[model samples]
Target chain A: MKTLTVDLGDRSYPIHIGSGLLGQSALWTPHIRGRQVMIVTNETVAPLYLAKVREALTAYQVDEVILPDGEQYKNLDTLNLIFDALLSRTHNRTTTLVALGGGVVGDMCGFAAACYQRGVDFIQVPTTLLSQVDSSVGGKTGVNHALGKNMIGAFYQPNVVLIDTDTLQTLPDRELSAGMAEVIKYGLIADAGFYQWVSDNISGLMRGEADLLATAIERSCACKADVVGQDETETGIRAILNFGHTFGHAIEAHQGYGVWLHGEAVGTGMLMAADYGYRTGKITRAELNGLRVMLEQAGLPIVAPADMGCEDFLSRMRIDKKVMDGRIRLVLLEKIGEAFVTTDIDTNALNQTLCAGAQLGY
Target chain B: MKTLTVDLGDRSYPIHIGSGLLGQSALWTPHIRGRQVMIVTNETVAPLYLAKVREALTAYQVDEVILPDGEQYKNLDTLNLIFDALLSRTHNRTTTLVALGGGVVGDMCGFAAACYQRGVDFIQVPTTLLSQVDSSVGGKTGVNHALGKNMIGAFYQPNVVLIDTDTLQTLPDRELSAGMAEVIKYGLIADAGFYQWVSDNISGLMRGEADLLATAIERSCACKADVVGQDETETGIRAILNFGHTFGHAIEAHQGYGVWLHGEAVGTGMLMAADYGYRTGKITRAELNGLRVMLEQAGLPIVAPADMGCEDFLSRMRIDKKVMDGRIRLVLLEKIGEAFVTTDIDTNALNQTLCAGAQLGY
Candidate 1:
């Protein structure tokens, strides 16, 4: 078992990573402040791990809401289901909501907690690799809007994030690879050694080797925690956390939310950013190739959709949350393991990068 | 103009009170960091005050979304319109939202700002006296659910609260009385002198005497600011701020929202709390009568809806946000100008208070 603390002063919480931690009451009970516990999960995860989580929360008045699975369900209409269940059960301000699925579930539940009665306590019990390595650590919780992804949300931190690695064993291979994009992102934005380590162990991590996967999760969260602790609300350096997210969000928005998994879009988005870096002479060809090879080895997408043109990417990117003063700010790589946000894009160069399409990162 | 600051460290903002603060660019422009400004107003307020607000923001890229007026529209479904307008306008994280109506507009816009791209800057331009005295000073921003009022929202503070008292001249007689319910409340919970002053000058204030209304607004905001600064999230002393809200929410939820204005319900609720205080020997009968007379003189309801019985009140109050565990915690008056929250209610006494019907606060 490995534990990493996201130090956020009063909002600080621990990320507990290990196998079979779901049924362990001692691991989560201390975080459950109120007797009324509502477990928010989805249809996919409910049948698998809901009972284990329910078992751990027996001492409290437990209620559960099982939402339809998928990124497409991550919107305000779907988010209201959790609120309905809470109101029907008379869950009060003291009630603590437990998010028990992947990123979609965690994001909705955390946001529900934030808005329910003007904010309540919520604990994250992430059941997927993408969530464990990414969503669970950051306090960014919200639902997606039809116009854009995560356009409606809050930065409400969780009481604790209990990551039971045993649940990842049930994740599909595609999902596993998608999670790797964020894991690799940690190395790209902040840690060169961690980046090299992720590249070296990419295949094993994809294969779900417990120790390697656990190590990757720990390192990724630690790197993210360090960044978030300094810039909790993304005023400055924290924007780098969305390194590939601008282009990734464009892909997600263009292709429809569920068409490409978030990590998959981000995986390809990182490659595009890397290609832009290479074209701008910020990184050597070998550095760009190194990132491309890692993403490919992890079985992630390396390019934007062939049909998505410069306008498609440009139009979607304009509405992204990262845009400021009508200028789209993107986190582009200066080098592998180093990224910076800039609105100083040359139109011709950006058009070339966008028009790169299938040839991106080749 | 009288300026009072709600000292919520870092999130602190000023409450500016006087005539014609709406067109003063110096007051609100300093608060708007971004060039894109979205003004959210209602149909009622737009025809009157929207043009003035727009004229003040001529320097920025201004957009406006006019929602249907009334508290009946204060729900999640209606809240979505703001999101739609924001996304369609390509408003980003830096965009500042100006709430230019009453409480409904302020609450929805503030919650929209809080959730839009995980928070943004917003200014409160409260037109109604109800909003100017209460909602603008407190950061309690949210929409209502069918099951309860204010069931979904956030404690998002504004950049500043500009109380243009001039707008109150156009306010209806009913709305003016409704606003007085909150003004009277400030005296009931924290200021005996203010309470007496409101009673002695109720008719003049209700008749739209500018000086008296301005003084009332200042005192109400100052009292609210003091309480909010002490307990922002209602962990302790701040619960007193909701002295009548628990019972008030029950009435509002039972009668259907907007059927009775929020302040009217709260006025009756305050009477009920005072009745409870009298029955419990916490205050004299004379004190209870004083509250009833003031509510009556102010043209506010002094009794709960006749159809609403003990069961209806209990059933709805049980789901209120103030409930902790299965116990319903209520803010009951200890005296004319002091209140306390308690979960220790004797069934018989509570039933007597609930069954008071038309005799309530008499």
Candidate 2:
């Protein structure tokens, strides 16, 4: 197992990347503070991993709350179930919640800990590639609102993130591509060399080469942890982390959450942002082409839905977290691996990008 | 207006105590950071104070979410209404929410501010004496859950607490007595001098004498703010501020919230706690009589509800925020104006106090 720490003083925690962490008692026991343990998982993941996790928590008084699976179920209504189970069982402030699934489970459970009794300790045992590389590393936990994605939430960090790469063996191919989009986002916003490494080894990641996937997950989390450490709350530089998310969240909202996986929308959103940056003359067409090739190389979407237009996109994007002072701020690429947030953009250029692949009726 | 600061370093804010603060835009404008304003109030307070608050924010774009009045409405469902309004209006992170009512409105709105897009700035425009003296002074904010009162929440502080003492004139007589419960609590737990002052000036306050009421609000807030500054998250010293809350919250929970006003429940809960303190040999019998006489003098209940018993109290108390590691912690009066938290009390003493008012089937 290789360990990487997200350097947040006092709240700092480790991300353990390994082949089989669920069966490892040491990784799970230290973070479990109280005698009572509430394991929050989903229907899709419980049958496969519940017994193993329960076995590991043998000494503690363990309880399980299994939710229906999917991103669409990620909302305030579903978030209530975790609260219900914890309260009905009379879980106190000292109780520690273990999120034992992918991003949705991790996000929902982490948020429940943040709000339950003001805040409680929680462990993120992220099972999928996307969560292992992205959501599991940062303390950004929240549920999606109908008008926008992740609108109601908190930036509550977990005690430790136990990433079991072995769980990736069961992830669907489409989900893998979604997770890759975020993995690629880290490289696109910060690391040029890492971006090149991912581009060169795209095939290995798709084929699920154990060593190659482990390297990618470790590198991605390191990049995220560095950025998050500099800015815990997005008052300034942290806003750049939402490079493709502004457009991505809009796509998720209008397309109806879960209709398109978060990663797919983000991958497509990156393409849209790359095109917008290129049209605005900040990014060269060649750099935009390189991003398109890489996204395509990883089986990611390079186009917005063929039906969405400039107005539809604008209406949804305007409500995203990226918008500030009524101006829609977006993470636009300056070069292949360099990005900047700018609200001052030419409307015609934005329209041109919006009308590129979709029917805009201009 | 007499101003006192909560002194929480960078998160520190001032509490403005005076008559007719609602019409004072100068008090309202400095804390409001953004152009977008959301006023979260209730139906009862809407006709009374909403228009006055909106008038004060006329320069900025304002929106409102008026909930049904009462404690029964302080839950996740009502919290959703605030989110719906904010989302529907596309209120950004820069949006400032103004909680323009009593403790219910302030608590719900403050929790809303804490959760809305991770968080946003909010001001507490407390319209009730209970809110001005107790809930509004501290940064504790949350909505109620079915299993427990304030079972789900965040310890997010408001940017400012705007206390308009003039609004107390419109408050009903019962509500005024309910507010006194907490006023009496301040004396019983931490301020002997203040307790005697209230005892001597009880009629003036009951009659809503402007000077007497103002003095009581400021002193109560000062006591609360001092404790909160030392322990913001209720780790140790802050728990003492909960004096009668272990039993108070249980009474509130079992009485079907909104039935017995929070202060009334606390008043009765304080009585039960006083008896327990006496039985445990922590306080003199004379001290216990002083508390009983003062509560009766304030028109507050000196006993628990006739329907509850040791078992009923135990079951509900187990789910309170004070419960840790399955042990129920209670705040006992070491002396008038002083209290401490302990979980090592004898069960018979607790039962004796609980069975005093309620006819238990023993």
Candidate 3:
């Protein structure tokens, strides 16, 4: 296993990435401060992998809260279920919570840990490539509300993150492609070479090649870790990490969560951002084409839904957390692998790009 | 106006404590980052004082979320109402939430702000003595759950805490007495001379003597501020602030929220802890007697309910957030002026103390 330290001083933790890292007592036991541990997962993942986690945690008294799967379940009601289980079992502040699934589970469990007795230590055992590379690393933990996705949450870092690529063997093809969207995001934001690498290794990655998969996870995590270390609260440099998210979150919010995978929405959103960047003369048409080509190769959508109007999209994007004051601030690319945040883009230019991207044939 | 700054560096903010301070634009407007501001209040305080607060913000766009009165309403359901109102009005992260009532409103609103888009600036406009003297100063914001009091919350500090004594004129006698419990607690745990002062001026304080109440609030806030400055996350010294809280929270949780005023339960719990302290040889019988006398004089309970058994109380306290590794940690008074946290108290001794205190006539 390869370990990367997140460098958050006392709140810092290790992100262990490799195959079969889950069930490694040396990685998890030291972080377990209390005798009781509660593992939070969802129905889909529980039936598939809960027993292995339970067996691995036999050294401590273990309790499980298996929730129904999907982003629709990531709400206050679901959060209360974990709270109810913890309170019923008399789990105190010292009891650690183990998040055992993808982004949905990680966000829900991380939020539950944050709300349980104010806050507690949580261990992230990311099961999907999407989570292993992105959501599992950042301390952004929250649940979505009916009005918006991730409307309620806290920036709480986990005590430890255990990434087991072995679980990816069970992830469906659609989910794997969705996860690759975020993997591609890291390259788009800061690493041109890595973006090119992903472009070259797209097929190898899709084939479940371990070495390439590991490299992608590590590079994405390292990129995220560096940005988080500089701006843990998403105040400055961290906003750049959300290069495609403003448009992507709007799509997810408009289409309804769980309809399109987060990575898929981000994938399409990144393409939209690239097209917008090209239209604004900040990026070359060739660079935008390269992004579209790679995403298409990964089997991800490169165009916005024809039914989603530019006005509605703009309105939805305006409410994004990244928007400050009345202006919608977006992280736009100046070139391939170089992103910058700005609210200065002309609305006419953005609208034209949105219209153009929407009409593009898939 | 007297301003005491809770120096949390970048998170540091001033506590403006004086008569009619809420009407002072200089104290509030600077903190208003954006034009949109939402004030959260309860039914009782709204008709009486909400207009004045709204008028004070005449230069900016203002909205109000008027919730029902009492601690029973401090929950996720009520919090969701605030979130709904903010979203319907399109309140972004720049939107400031001004908590304009007692602890219930302050906590619910602060927690709402903390969770709304991760977090937003929240200001405290405390209308009750209970809130002004205790809850308002500290950054401990949370909503209560049916299983436990403050079962879900975050340690989020306010941008400014505005205490206007003019609003206190409408407070009922019972509410004032309830607040006195926390004021007395600061003396019991950290300041012996303050305890003596309260003992001497208990009748005057109960009668709403302005100078005496001001002195008490200032001293109590200072003591709390000192502890919080050293331990913002309640790692050590701050736990002392929960001296009677473990037992008190259990009482609140068991009796059902709003059955007893929080300060009323804490008043009784403080007496129980003093008795426990004496039984464990950490405090003198004289100190315990002083605590009981002061509480009785303030018209607060000095004992637990006779209906509660030691086992029930023990079971409830064990689930407290302060519990670590299955052991119940408690804050006990060493003397009138000093307190310490310990888990060493014997169960039998605690049971004896509970029995003794309950037997004392209210």
Candidate 4:
């Protein structure tokens, strides 16, 4: 396993990336301090990996809550299911919750851990590329609202994040490509060398190349850990991590959550941000085209929805968490490996981008 | 006016106890960060102090969410009302939430603020003596599940705790007596002098003597602050703060919530703990009798519910957050003005207390 630590003083923990981690009970045991373990997964993940985790935690009192899979299910109503399961079973504060699925499960379970008896111990076993690269490492846990994505969440860290690359074998081609969007986001927002490497090995990643996948997961987590370590709650530098998220979350919310996968929206949002950057002279036309081509080649939508207009985008973005003191601050790219947050965005400029079909709720 | 600070570094905030604080906008103004503010209260509180708070926050864009009154309303479903209000109005991250009511309002609003967009700025305008002396000072915020009281919550501090003792002038006699339970608890667990003072002046407090009330509030807050400063998340010393809570929460939960006021339940729970202490030779029978007399004189219950059996108490108490490693750890009184936590409790002693119609969730 490749270990990367998110340095958060006393709250810090290791992010382990490797194959067959679910089968490795040793990696999952020590972190669970309490004997009562609640494994929160999803309908899709339960049949595949739930038993593996259950088997690994044989000696402990294990309780399982399998929620409906998908972004649409990521809401307070669904979160109640996890709470109900834990409460009905008389799970105590000392009980350890293990999130055993993708970003949605991890986010919801981590949130349940956060609010369960004011807080409880939770470990993350991320089973998707998006989670392996982004969501699982950061302490950001929440459910979606009708207004915005990730708006109802907390900055609660995990005890450990176990990423088993072997699980990616079951990932559909589209899902794998969707996960690649976040993988691309990591490179776009911070690491130029990784971006170039991704450009060269995109085929290998899509083909589930183990060594390439491990390296990508490692570097992505490292970049994210560094950013999260500096700012856990997105006060300043951490906002850069939401480079494409503002647009992405809006796209998801407006399109009815599950319509567009999180990575799909983020992938398209990144392209739109690049376009806006180009229009505002923050990036060269060639840079914008390069990002557009890379995203399209990765099988992501780069245009606005046929139905949504500037007003729709504006309303959706207005309800976002990034709207600070009424101004919709956005993460705009200056170059492929660089992004910055700015509130000086002109509506006229934004209208043009929104009219062009896309640049970014709960 | 008097102020006490809960020194928790960055999370540290002030607790202001005085008359006319609510009328003075300046006291409530500084803590509100953004121009937008949401006041979360109950139907009962809205009729009483909502307009007063509205007058104070006239300079800002304000919204209000009035929930049904009582402890039964302090649940996730009711909490959704706050989220709905925030989302419907498009309240952003910078928006501030003002909790205006008693402990239930403060708790639900504080929790809503804690989870809304993963947390927003919140100010506590506690109207009850119970809240002002206890809940308002601590940053612990959350709602309850059917399985337990305060089962779903967070350890989120408020920007400022506004305790307008003037509001207590309109408080009913029963509510006043209920509030006294917590005031007496502060003295029982840590400050023997405060305990003696309460013993000496119970009638004055019941009579609503402003000076006496202020002193009780100040002293209770001081003892609570001293303990909470040492342990914010109940890892150690803070558990002592829950001396009566284990039994109290079970009483609240088993009774279908709102049947027994939180302080009332704690009052009975404290007597139960004292009885258990006496049974185990941890405290003198004389000490137990003394605390019981004080609670009884303060107009609080000193025994368990008549309808509840030993099994019910056992089951409900088993669901408590303090149950670590499968052993139900309890906060026990070693003697008057002193307390400690122990999992070494005997079930026979516990059952005997429960059968005795006294002694110590969803």
Point to the candidate with the largest DockQ.
Answer: 1
Off by over 4 Å in 1: none
**Which window of ten consecutive residues has the lowest lDDT sum in model 3 chain A?**
A353-362
Query: Which residue pairs overlap in candidate 3's backbone?
Result: none
Tens-digit lDDT track of model 2 for B144-259: 88999898899999999988889999999888888888888888889999999998999889988989999999999999999999999999898887888888888888889998
**Clashing pairs in model 1?**
none
Q: If candidate 4 were superposed on the true structure by all CA atoms, what would the RMSD be? A: 2.7
Q: Candidate 4: lDDT over CA atoms? A: 0.87
- A1-362 in candidate 2: lDDT tens per residue? 99999899999998888987898888888898789999999999999999999888899999999999999999998999999999999899989999998889999999999999999999999988889988887899999888888899999999999988989999999889999998889888888899889989998899889899999999998888888999998887777778788778877888898989889888988888878877767777777777788888788877788777778889998888878888988888777677888888788988887778742111
Q: lDDT (0-100) at residue B55 of candidate 4?
A: 89
Model 2, residue pairs in steric clash: none
* Candidates, DockQ: 0.89, 0.85, 0.76, 0.79
TM-score versus the correct structure, for each prediction: 0.98, 0.98, 0.97, 0.96
Off by over 4 Å in 3: B281-287
| Chain A accuracy as TM-score for every candidate | 0.98, 0.97, 0.98, 0.97
For A76-146, candidate 3 gives per-residue lDDT tens digits of 99899999999889888778999999899999999889888888889999999999999998799999888
List where candidate 4 sits over 4 angstroms from the true fold: A358-362, B358-362
Chain B, candidate 3: TM?
A: 0.98
TM-score-better candidate, 2 vs 4: 2
Indicate the docking level reached by candidate 2. high
Cα RMSD for predicted model 2: 2.1
Q: Pick the candidate with the highest TM-score.
A: 1
Deviation of model 1 at A109, angstroms: 0.8
